[model samples]
Target chain A: MLYIICMVAGLLLSRALRLERIARPIGWAQTAVTLILIACMGYRLGSRPDFIHELSSMGLMSLLYCIVPSVFSIALVYVVTRFLLKEKKNGRNRDSW
Target chain B: MVILALIALLIGTLAGMLAPHSGMLAVLTNATDIYLVVLMALVGITIGFNEGIVDKLKRHTLHIIVVPTCIIVATILGGVVCSFISGYPMNISTAIAAGLGWYSLSGVTMTNLVGAQIGTITFMSSLMREIFSFMTIPFISRYMNYSSAIAPAAATSEDTTLGMMIKYTDAEHVVVSLLNGTIISAAVPFLIPLCLAVF
Candidate 1:
């Protein structure tokens, strides 16, 4: 949490200093970090002694669990955005309130 | 820059694969979250300071906020429906986990709570969400005002998308997207877990 706060503060300070060009570099850095975090989490998961057995037991059920929520969320978002939002002259919708 | 980050991520994954000890690789892996948050904040500040961002927000604040809200709501509803259809108890915690693709935080948090497979599912789902949002931004913008596109686009990477939106679309959308991303990202850590616990 403190780390996040420091990061936000640093960015704000950078912006105040007019260093807008640095944003992309910073963003790329963040992406790299996020990937590492994911890998670490994977490693931790893989290291557990029961993990393989648990995974095997999960089998097809695991796949279903994963796919169902994901597809549903994306489809839901798409449907609502498409149906509820009014289209403009260009067939584009405005993105405000 | 995204390319560079991707390369770095590739290298990290490879290192993890090749390493003798898993924990050694885990340290390297965990670094990505810190990098992402800092980078996102920097992107946010840049967008926040842009004059055109404010102008765009003034022009289309309503569209910007509402569209993303609709998308998020849809995501939640879909999660619920899928849970029911799959015969798995609806796990709101899991749905919330999938909703925030920030991966580093939400993924870890879910792992600590629900176990790894579920966490992996959340991580992958979130990644998909981000990628989908990123790839669709241009197409979405063509149909909607840039501000509206910013909402979902920023759902993945505020800084990267905001920059792209500013360069390619309306300036006002860039600022509004940044602001919106900031707010949503902040909520993700807590909301995902809460939602997971609820359903």
Candidate 2:
């Protein structure tokens, strides 16, 4: 709930203020925040010891389990968007669909 | 920017690997979401600034309808196929996650509603979908017009990728993509939970 509110607030505030022109600058700021957050996450993780053992225990199956759905989803999106929708338009050929 | 993201991912992964407590690792993992949101917000602002909402609406009305419609349809089909292929019981959250091509919200929601294992699978799969989208955008766009490419690009905005889409793709498409993506992204957090609860 709070997350949703923050997102909505940020979006509304940014729009209300006409912060679009300075988007790149804002982007940089957001990027900085993201970096810091990621760093904090990493620091927190590094401070723990048992995480390594658990991750190792999962091993190759973990990688496969994580990767398979992603591959399948992308393939599905591509095939459906391309062949099924028949909306495939390259740069050279602009067909009026 | 891509390099920076890769560095962050590496650092996060390393931290997760090194952490002793699962709770600490979870915090680190959640940080990725924070990073993603901030990046997406900036992407939205940049897109909004470059292409005013009114103009973007006028330009991409068709695309806005077409892309999400396609994605939703594709997601439903994909979920069914995934359920059958994986031999796992299908549910709404997994379907939506597969459809949205990102698990961050849907996976977590499913976990809360269903169980941790399913949630983990959804997250992994959705993460893969995001990575795949990032890699294939250029190749896919090569065969697509501005709108189709832009809509999904906007739909899947991340720190490293949205800027590339904007820089390389048509302005109208970028605007449409951003707007469309923002709508879907916003809905995901709420809708995923609702879907999980209801179904």
Candidate 3:
């Protein structure tokens, strides 16, 4: 709820304030935030004794469960989008949008 | 960037284990939620900051529809196959897959709708989805179309994972990703319930 609001506010604010000059830096900030979020999640996992104990047993299944879906999604989307992009490669409509 | 991000996570995990300095680490854990909000706002600013993206989005609007449909179908199919191999019911796997990458919601929803057993699997699997999301962003961007790279992140685009996508993909994909995130997030309530009801 608030997340959407803040994001919309930021977007509208940027539009009004002409913040394009600093958009690059904001992008860097996003990467930094992502890194911090990932590390924090790792730290939380480490602190959980139950998770660590169960981690060994669930390791392989967990890996399979995670990788397979992502691989499938990527493979499907990649193939279709590649065909789409290739079709649009001709100069006639290139970069028009 | 992905490697460095993983290294940072490794170090944070090691620190948490060695120190268990619950005081500071607890604060850090709580702070992540706040940080997430800030990041989302920054993403909006970046998106709004770009004046031309709206035009780009209009041109590639079809992508918003096609790509997510592929991801959703693939994810559900994979989940069904995986459930069969793992000796679970197809319904359980479908609900889990329907979670996309939003672990917290999936975890709780599965637990309440099903049992703790399936719920635990949902939590872990979706968490893995998120890890894979962060892991694949750069690699996919390099080898595949930027739009497809967003597949791994699934539902995180509205929040935690959006940043990396914006960093790796182009302006147009970001718009698509935001749409993907919202759609997947919205789908959660309906789809998870649908999977459970069918079971």
Candidate 4:
């Protein structure tokens, strides 16, 4: 995929280049770009003629779908990491683990 | 950052409502893919800049696989439960859950497989998943474990939400998050369709 390629390319480029000085700027740029994309997403959603109707009609169902799966994911991951991975509650073994 | 994101969303929505066909809106919407690509590259560079990232990734190669696998199974189980509770049919519910927070792809795919209503639901649900992950990552990382924090992020953990991972968790978990995201992202397309057809 293009996304994967771009990521790998960037990674290789960064590794080859001396970019320590610009790291903060790179982070800022990433955040700004992310904000723009988020705004664009909002624009796309809001520009729909039926935005309000769609939200009102499907919002609850959508929320349900989001919450249930995410909760399950969190719970399961917690169990696995705590029991199987033997990770601590506060994640003190961050790097050592 | 979260506050800024919310403000951007609100402002963008207002602008869209006021000038739905504005040239700026058109440009921003059309160039979304470009923005996304740049974001991905930036994220990659961030990771690459970390001198020890590769070593960390290698250290946890086996453990990395476990996170995504658990997420996938938990998500599907959640879908089954959702189907029973929402009465939306097992296939549709499961398909939506299989999205794994990749909104645009899953939303469009579900739309094509089913219809606009289901598509819209998929879009909103997955979008909510991303937003919720943004809000909850801090708490999850603090109270729960670093790995569990990645669960709410799913596929987006690689790029869109990698910043959160970087901010809240450590380098080791960030490496795991990236791998978890890649695995989940690869699975979403196949999983959604498979859920639709099989369940």
Candidate 5:
């Protein structure tokens, strides 16, 4: 997949070159690209012919599918991480995980 | 960025609703894929470059790795249970959950193995999973631990859904998401076929 390749390329780039001076710049570029990608995603969804048809129907079901499991999993992770793991070195404490 | 994405989706939906017809959705889809791939690379570079990431991983390995493992199991269970109650056969329901929110691949796989009707449902379900991530990341970040926010997107927590993760969480979570996605994505191939085999 192009997805894996691109990420591997990035890792390769990081290794083969210093890029030390431009690390921050590269970060900025990543931010910009991410913004553009999100917008483009919106564009594709908007362009779909069946967006509304599906939305009122399967969309709602899909939402239920996503919500229930996500809620259950998050709760599970919260309990496991908060109670099971020892506290971190940073003293941010219970406020942030 | 969540607001930005929301606005963009709104504008895009309006555009999609208004347009007479367009032949370019396919092209845009490919472009988005390429663009996202690039973003993934950039994210990888950041991770590859960050020496501290390993240390962070050592500290948070349990959190980073185990969270997704738990989520994968929970999601599959939810899918199997819901589909069974709704009348689908056991294998089909399990296969659908095995999708892990990578809708297109899962949908097509189901279509090839099952049929259009269930395939479409699986596709819609997975697609909604991704869409739901966009809508929920901001809220998830607010209400839950940043990493727990990765749950809904599931496999896409590493890919297309990643921008929202970066927006709501941080680059650090972004890296963790890549790991999370990799693990879930790897599970998909084995899980889908294994479920389908039961059919």
Candidate 6:
């Protein structure tokens, strides 16, 4: 709920103000923030005891757990959007909305 | 962007391993929640800057839901297959899949509820999902429809993977990615427990 509210507030605010001039800056900030978050995630994971040991031991199992679900998700989403939503097979859909 | 993210992750991991007790590392790690919230708002602002996105949003109100639903169902089905192949209990397999790329929460939750081994699997698998999404979003955007790019991302699409969505896809798909992530993220906690109990 908080996330939704913040996003809606941002959307409304940006729509009201002419924010185009700062788009580049915003993109750069996004990149910085994203890297920071990823770094933090890495820290959390790496700081855990036996992190490497666990990864080496359960690597195959974990990989299976990750790969199968992602594959299924990608396949299903593609099929549905392709056939059900009837989206074009173009390379990208910048104006898809 | 992807290369930079990988480098950031590597540096952070090395820092963490070397100085696990560093006050600075702890503060930055703990502040991630705040950072995520800000990122979401920024995502909204980015979308808003795209002309006519709101109107486009309205036109596809009903259709926008298709992405997340497919992801949830497919993930569960994949879990079922993993159960057969890996010989783990269906309940545990599905519960792990229910993490939906939110590794931290799922890891802690499973650690508390289940045993450490299962928890580790949950954490590692979900973490891999996130890392894989980071790598695959570009290819998915190129080979499939823009909306399909959000599939691999699952719950991370809202914040962590939004960068990929913004760069590889367009504003409209970013909206879908955000909505899909929020819905799945909301479902993850309940879904994990529900799968454990019911299946």
- Alpha-carbon lDDT, every model: 0.54, 0.52, 0.71, 0.81, 0.65, 0.78
Error of 1 at B38 (Å): 5.3
Residue B146 lDDT, candidate 1, scale 0-100:
51
**lDDT tens string, model 2, A1-97?**
6556566666676778888667767867866765555444444434445545544433332344334443443455455545644545442222432
lDDT of 3: 0.71
Taken in order, the candidates have interface RMSDs of 5.2, 5.6, 5.8, 4.2, 6.4, 5.2
Q: Candidate 3 — which pairs collide?
A: none
lDDT of 3 by residue, B68-118 (tens): 788888988888778877776888778878878866556545655675445
* Tens digits of lDDT, candidate 3, A1-97: 5566777788888898888888678878877875776566566656655656765655566666777788999988888777765423111233523
Residue-level lDDT tens digits of model 2 in B1-199: 4356447645855665565456855664555455556655654454445445676667556556665555544455555555555555555533444426444445444444554445444544555556656766676667654444443332465333566577666555555566666655665666555545554
| Model 5 regions lying over 4 Å from their true place | A1-64, A86-97, B1-60
The 10 consecutive residues of candidate 5 chain A with the worst lDDT sum are: A86-95
Go through the candidates in order and give the clash count of each.
28, 5, 0, 0, 0, 0
Better of 1 and 6 by DockQ: 6
> Taking the tens digit of each residue's C-alpha lDDT, what string does model 6 give over A1-97?
4556766777777788877779888878767876777677667667878878866767798899999999999999889888766775543343433
The CAPRI classification for model 2 reads as acceptable
Could you say which candidate leads in DockQ?
4
Better of 4 and 5 by TM-score: 4
TM-score of every candidate relative to the true structure:
0.64, 0.62, 0.61, 0.68, 0.59, 0.65
Worst 10 residues of 1 chain B by lDDT: B1-10
- Candidate 4 off by > 4 Å: A1-54, A94-96, B1-57
Mark the regions of model 1 whose C-alpha exceeds 4 Å error after superposition. A1-8, A49-85, A88-97, B1-52, B85-98, B131-154, B157-183
Chain B TM (all candidates): 0.66, 0.65, 0.70, 0.74, 0.69, 0.72
lDDT by residue (B58-131, candidate 5, tens digit) is 75576677778788778767766767555677787778777778764565456546754455566657766777
Off by over 4 Å in 2: A36-88, A91-97, B1-6, B9-51, B84-89, B92-127, B142-154, B157-175
Question: Can you write out model 1's per-residue Cα lDDT over B1-199, one digit (the tens) per residue?
Answer: 3444335434543554456376656665455445546554654454445545566666666555664565455456656665665555677434533455564556655665676666655655555556556676677567644544554443554655666666656654455566666656655655665676677
Candidate 3 vs candidate 6: which has greater DockQ? 6
Candidate 4, B2: how far from true, in Å?
Answer: 11
Q: What TM-score does candidate 3 reach?
A: 0.61
